[model samples]
Target: MEYEAATRHFAALGHPGRLSVVRLLLRHAPRGVRPTEIAGTLGMKSNTLSHHLAELEGAGLIGSAREGRSLFYTVRLPELAALIAYLGQDCGRGRPDLMPTHPTEIDMDRPFNVLFICSGNSARSIFAEAILRSLGGTRFRAFSAGTRPNSVLNPFAIEVLERNGLDTSGLRSKHVAEFEGPEAPRMDFVFTVCDQAASDECAPWPGQPLTAHWGMPDPAKAEGTDAEKGLAFAKAFGELHRRISAFTQLPFDQLERLALQQHLDRLGEA
Candidate 1:
């Protein structure tokens, strides 16, 4: 594949939600996942999961078939193999010693570690963490924590995520203090997804990561029928998806720290 084609493929796999789907398929390998199971597992709605599944299928990373009322999907192993081989198509052809390297030791797929903070960790922050991680893929590692975490995820959040067929397994609300100690991972970016978390003065941030406030409306606060709540969650996910897609496409190496920060500010506004 050409570089552009490869980049697009990588970009397609960038979202944390999409990556979750890809990982699931890869884990299952020869046996594909069915649409209903995917939806039920992720707490997503059937229609929304279909959209994400279609995107994966379009990227040539997955294949699907219909069995009665259900649709099954499988990871296309050969397609993944071809993509890997294309990355090294010209290896050692000229200066084998001159292969491009990352500016830092961290994997490009695992660009700056990200942490999303909020008060409850029940809705918006969880959405941000999952969507950003799935959408950003390995380009960034995303996590969520609350100043005072809830015991369980919001049911609506679970509903929407499952509808989109994202992996909701092993997810739990966490206290922000867990990330404040000396042993915490160095965060490249720290975002507060709610006003309270943004304005909190007691947070003991260690590394002074680039901090930003993204005041996303609470999905839990959404008042409506189940369908309405799902729509709100979907809207929030789409907004984050768009902003993040733009941010990830920028040439970070060419931008100064201040410029990059400014760009991120604009992204938050988006």
Candidate 2:
């Protein structure tokens, strides 16, 4: 980062309002928030929020994307990281404690709680919960939920899990709200397993959990004979299994938050 560029970034965040905006955006990283929601959450007038957003974007501290009719804003993590690095460039000279450490380094002794989400809790998300439950052993606790959940679990999904020797007795469809309340478990990670759910406006999860989109084809929408539908569900199961297996094998204690997030986004592509 050039000194000039660093100065620009600092200038953008110099205002109290702008700094608050940046903090809120960081909490919702990887999931862009719409301008209306930002305004509502921060109690800022639309005109004022727009000015701040423009300034942040001009400084490359934030970025936006058009999703359908809405423009969503997200913090540019790499740029922010560069600014932090520029500030702390010489921290190791004498202040070893001032050097940054990975968040997971302090939490490695406890099991991580992971939540998988989808449009319907019936299929893909459920498959993920089961796969992680079986593969993660005591190192991870997996949960699943939906944005608009069906009343019952998808039969084909259950069939596929049973065929693969996974327990299905306790699995059922659940709303995302179930996990959003004050009483809900704090999640270490949250993943969206379908494109529709990924694009939906989700409530800000408690704990500001690390999130990623891991979209897969919806097997519940699969049309064919029972055998073919079962195959579709089985394929979904395999894909989630592969992803979760890779996730469990990650070196959490060694990777920083940003690096861990990058690995998660890459797994979605895989």
Candidate 3:
């Protein structure tokens, strides 16, 4: 970072309110926190929180995105990394112990929590959840939800899973809100398997999981004879199986956050 840039970031952090905002954002990390949540947590009035957020954003310490009716603020990891590097540049000269270390590994002590989302919890997202459940073994715990979940799982989706020897007894459509509460499992990754769900506004996930759009055509929309509709569901299952298989093969312990994010985005295109 340039001297001017470093000074600007330092100036931004000079205020106690701005520093507190940064700390709160860091706790949320990759996932964005809504302004209301931030204000509530910090006990800052709306106008005061807005000013601090703007200052931090202007200094490149944070970024924001609009999701439905909510605006979410997230820490700018690269910029934060650069600022830390600038501050610790001299630490390598003699005191290596004082130098910062970047985390390249994810916690492996517990099974990684994964969520698959769609507009309806009927087919694509359900298939993904099941595929991951079977293939992921003890390494992953998978869940699925929808923006506007149907009353039940799509019959074709269930048939396809059964034909492939996947368990369907406990599977059911679920609203995304079910996973947004404080008691919900903290997801490590969340994927949207259809365009509608990818574009829909969703509640911010609890853990601010790494997210990506893995959109595919909705198999339930197929109109044809039973065999043809079943074929469509089968095709959807095949695509999801391929993606989830690739996801499980990633070198989680070796890739850092940015690299892993890039990998996830590319998987959507694949």
**lDDT value, residue 177 of candidate 2:** 91
Q: Give per-model TM-scores.
A: 0.56, 0.67, 0.63
lDDT per residue (tens digit) for residues 80-138 in model 2: 98888776764344354665544453278789999999988998999999999999999
The most accurate candidate by lDDT is: 2
For residue 164, give model 2's deviation from the true position in Å. 0.2
Each prediction's number of clashing residue pairs: 20, 0, 0
- How far in Å is the alpha carbon of 157 misplaced in model 3? 0.8
What local lDDT score does residue 91 receive in model 3, on the 0 to 100 scale? 30
What lDDT does model 1 reach? Answer: 0.71
Ranking by TM-score: 2, 3, 1
Top TM-score prediction, candidate number: 2
Which lDDT values do the candidates have, in the order given?
0.71, 0.86, 0.85
Could you tell me the lDDT of residue 65 within candidate 3? Answer: 100
Backbone clash total, candidate 2: 0
Clashing pairs in 2: none
Off by over 4 Å in 1: 1-110
- Cα lDDT tens digits, model 1, 1-270, are 666667767877887777767765653444556777666656678887788888888888889988788778987877776676665554444354544332232234446788888888877778778777677766787888887754568887888777877778867888887777778887877877765565444454555566556666766777879888888878877776676678667776677665666677677666
